[model samples]
Target: MNGKVLLVEDDASIATVIRSALEDEGFAVDRCESIAARDRALASDRYDVMLTDVMLADGDGIASIDSVRAACPQMPLIVLSAQNTLDTAVRASDTGAFEYFPKPFDLDDLVRAVVQAGGSGDKRGEEAEAGDGLPLVGRSQAMQAVYRMITRVLRNDLTVLVLGESGTGKELVAEAIHQLGHRKSGPFVAVNAAAIPADLIESELFGHEKGAFTGAIAQAIGKFEQANGGTLFLDEIGDMPIEAQTRLLRALQSGRIRRVGGRQEIAVDVRIIAATNRDLKPMIAAGQFREDLYYRLNVVPIVLPPLRDRVEDIEALAKHFLGLAAREGLPERRIDRPALALLEQQPWRGNVRELQNAVYRLALMARDDVIDAGTVTAVLGDPAEAVMRGRDDALGAALAAWLGDNAPAHGTLYHRAVSAFERPLFEYALGQTGGNQLRAAKLLGINRNTLRKRLGELQINADSFARAE
Candidate 1:
């Protein structure tokens, strides 16, 4: 047998399909229908991996995850759940299951997880702390999977590959990981592989000695060198040239780099967090990106949800942006309930970034302090008649709109809104003043102590914002 599989599933049809697939792949699969049967099998035999369903006929598969680990401490357990809720996904990560597959999962994908689990860590993985205040906010089931994936890699130095559509906040995720990780004190150097000319990509990443080439009049540190103690965010990595990819792969493999036209090898201790809006597998097939490099950067992968998939978060995100626009010296404005409803109904192909820009534009264009549905529809370019369509019916629109898709959580939403708005507001202010806190405060017309309080409350490190602002 290539490897042993302990399959715990009560559904006969699903179990038969899984067993057939594993058996075809040369895995010796022992199928059990209940927790008692699973326990008995584990007691009598050893297995390389375990695949357990979340809802077993005789047990709750999601809750049984930890107990399964107790029975076979070294076995990597994969959770398959029909529940497929946000809570279920979080529980799977909490229990340190190697992977969580929702019901109706692709057989091939489940097989891949089982095979991959052969080399995964044995100990129940650490649960990612949610203390950073959920920077990537969306309680949607899709976002839940993303959050779980993000938590899995927080404490490790694993190279992360974040995949998402344009303006989906890929860089934000990278920044969060760096800020939350051990390298918070180090610099974060960002390089856009797509933006740089192909000719300059090498020097941009690997540095160049004086007289290395034309315009190389002085020795300059590259992104890799500057990020030696921290993270190097490589955005649009799928656009990298094949030649640069080769050098990057070699540098990553050896943990050292030789500057252009220089013989000295400099050792670098930097973690890589890369993002791409493009699907790299297709690029690899086209001979554009290197396969080995993809594996290296994708040691752990996270995919962000598009705005359409998590529209419920739009209201909160909109309110936060509205507050930000005000802080940016735009006229202070409040979004009325109907305006929020009207905002939610649009097709936001541009995702969160589009929504933010729209809100800012609305703030600038709205004629009154209270922005109503008419303004939102007008800004969204709906029919002119739809403007102020329900201005008289604004009372229940926003709350009812939110209630339709989102179950309000306990506690006041006010603090979270303030925390979300102030961090970026201060960061932008500080960045504007070259990280001089006093100057930033002066620019914002606030006392330095008050600025300090917001930063402390939000767990934001002022030093990190120094360059970013």
Candidate 2:
């Protein structure tokens, strides 16, 4: 076949016209009236492009595009819509639509689209690379999985749900999807659901009329409307309010939304890619989230692993951050082997963001060109004495636990009383230094004289607590 096309439409007249036009252009066309038929055609044969209507008598047209893209990631999709609204176009585009045509569109226009699709070369090949000149970073298996998924989803627009911890680069993943997908030319509009106030989320997403609320001084375009002919990234989606979820679901389902306090429904063309750190499944179970909304947004789920779990990539990530910092004018910063080792050894509870902050701090504070383990400890470790004190406390607790189990209540009251005073004294000093007694005393809301007296009475040594500064 010179060009193979999957022409899906419920109206026989429309399908017949499209199929005839395609065949006349020396293309082989397969026609399907329903999603099931479309799937059968998809499974049995390969096509260069798929022409689908927005509404099917049997199932949704956009949903069908998602299903087809799942099996054939690189197949181009052109949406045919009678609705002819920006919302319909945006929705179509978001699902990786190659182009959209309104009802009564000329057959020549479609043929031109088909010809363009063919000229673009093989539809099945070419892993979608990022368009922003920033390639996906990280060599971890988790990042590799993300890379594969990004390639799969690049050819088509499928509502993508990116799940990851804070600072795990969810926005980067979303940007990659938009850059690699069919709508590469379209804009990427990112919105943080959690950042918007509860009262303004709806307006932020779906726009507002001039008089929608007290603060509505002018007619404002929402992220969805602005993202027409592009991608809309909703970050921290799990933090989105239930009321906003309902509105979002309605927009997703109907491909239309009324501006806040507006009577008319405005159309918007956009692709929705949402990211969140929280688990939406349990939220659904707890009735904090809607099950239907979850299903709609979760058509393509990509989970990003925390940095600690992908320890193999830590050094690479550190280098990447350090290079970035250097370019940003922090040229004096350079991590040595010992510093990298220290980074690798420490638990990264805060993930990538925390690491980025640490690198920035190193760049800002390093006394020499090469950042050593001591500098790493100075910037990252709890004030030296605090870390030591914390370690000592852990040891003391272990010993106490062993003694309690083996030796029992013998002289326990005096020892317990001693522990109580000693623990507070150490904790106070630690808190003062940020756990350094010299620094701690200044901050203890106390004079050094008083702090010294208390430490003496409690039998606590300040020098032993000093971090290896």
Candidate 3:
């Protein structure tokens, strides 16, 4: 509180309000309206912290920070911006700013950040270049919280637990952290706990040795080893078996893993980013999931808002999906205002993924270049029906159809049904990965040899799915 702060903002009212707040906290404030004045002031006096607006009278405040750093390299910098997009937030973080406050931010939070920055000394580092075409979309206030939380963890390797309903883009948040953080140069390995069979979960994570178990033909690396020096994204962590959870907690605690049937413990350097659609509290109470594991992963929790809660973002999200669909070889189509309104009114129980699918359907089925309300209704079905047609209903109908069409003998039904579902599943994975066995195995949370064996047994010619390099 007994430090000097430089304020570089052009708005008189905002400047006055901030000045009053800072002075009331027992700090001396120096005000400047332009980058030129800021540089001049920094050249003359040393301050503990500098609070600057991104847009200034003379130039972009964030862009002009080189001169400020040259003038007072030790001062902690705080960025305030009205442009509340993810790009802007990342730009501010790329500057190594102590904190970034979007427009209409809480005044008390700003003051506390200033106080912390003033006492923390220098917070700058080698600025990481922000990547282009970031995956996350939407700029609603609800999303602002998500963006800010994402920026806070880029500079560190803290464990992040992303919680949200299915299809809420939890993995996207994890990907953003890895792509934008210091680990961008390293490999990003992902595994879904719920997708793998319970017996294989540990081997899928910590690897296995040759002859470790039945059909363990050769030594294989695990997700941990593959993600060394980078990030390991554990999706659906809540569904991991209790025994695997204990091993996972141990690995997190010791930073080491013992391969199955191996005597020596191998050390791994990887950042963990876990996400789940299930609430762990109930599972913990029931002793289904370990309480200790929950706390270890919950070091930094980021809760994603469901799409139904953030209705304002539907239009932007819908348009984004439309663009993506067109780029992916779908017919190009734009939604009319009425169509967009219809989209916003539905309860997107499946969140962003459902909306993206709906948009793709609309793009493919629309007769006219411009999609209207009638087309939306026709292509996606009535809003009420769409809401009722959740994932369970679709799966149930598919199962019923399969059962009716192929009435296998009672004892053989399970095997036949599993093979029926897995054929298309394996094909889809191969198609998505351009027939790269290694990548498809990762996508499906199974071993590479297993995928190859399944493909051969199912008479799937993987070469047909291969893309021209």
> Who wins the lDDT comparison?
3
Instruction: State the lDDT of candidate 3 residue by residue for 1-469, as single tens digits.
Output: 5799999999999999999999999999999999999988998988999999999889899998999888787889999998888888999999888999988888999999999998898766778888988888887888889998999888888999999999999989998999999999999999999999999999999999999999999998999999999999999999999999999999999999999888889999999999999999999999999999999999999999999888988998999999999999999989899999999877787899989998999999999999999998887778876666665677888888888866777799778778789998998999999988999999999999998998888899989999997
Report the number of backbone clashes for model 1: 3
Model 1 TM-score (2 dp): 0.57
Query: What lDDT score is found at residue 128 in candidate 1?
Result: 48
- Judge candidate 2 against the unseen true structure and give its global Cα lDDT, from 0 to 1: 0.79
Model with the higher TM-score, candidate 1 or 2: 1
> What tens-digit string does per-residue lDDT give for candidate 1 at 1-469?
6798999988899999999998998899999989889888988998999898878788787666566677777888898877654456656766667888877678998888888896674676465433334356555667757755765665678999999999888998888777656677889999999999999999999999999999999998899999999999999999999999999999999999989989999999999999999999988997988999999999889999898788787887898888889999999999988898877776676789988999999999999998898888767777334335544345347446645655547775565455545677788887787778899899999999998887778776767655542
Off by over 4 Å in 2: 1-132, 382-469
Once superposed on the true structure, which residue ranges of model 1 sit more than 4 Å away at CA? 1-134, 383-469
List the global CA lDDT of all models.
Answer: 0.82, 0.79, 0.91
Candidate 2 per-residue lDDT, tens place, 126-162, comes to: 3343343544467655665565466567666789999
* Residue 355, model 1, lDDT: 88
Superposed by TM-score, candidate 1 places the C-alpha of residue 33 at a distance from the truth, in angstroms, of 30
Query: In candidate 3, how many clashes are counted?
Result: 0
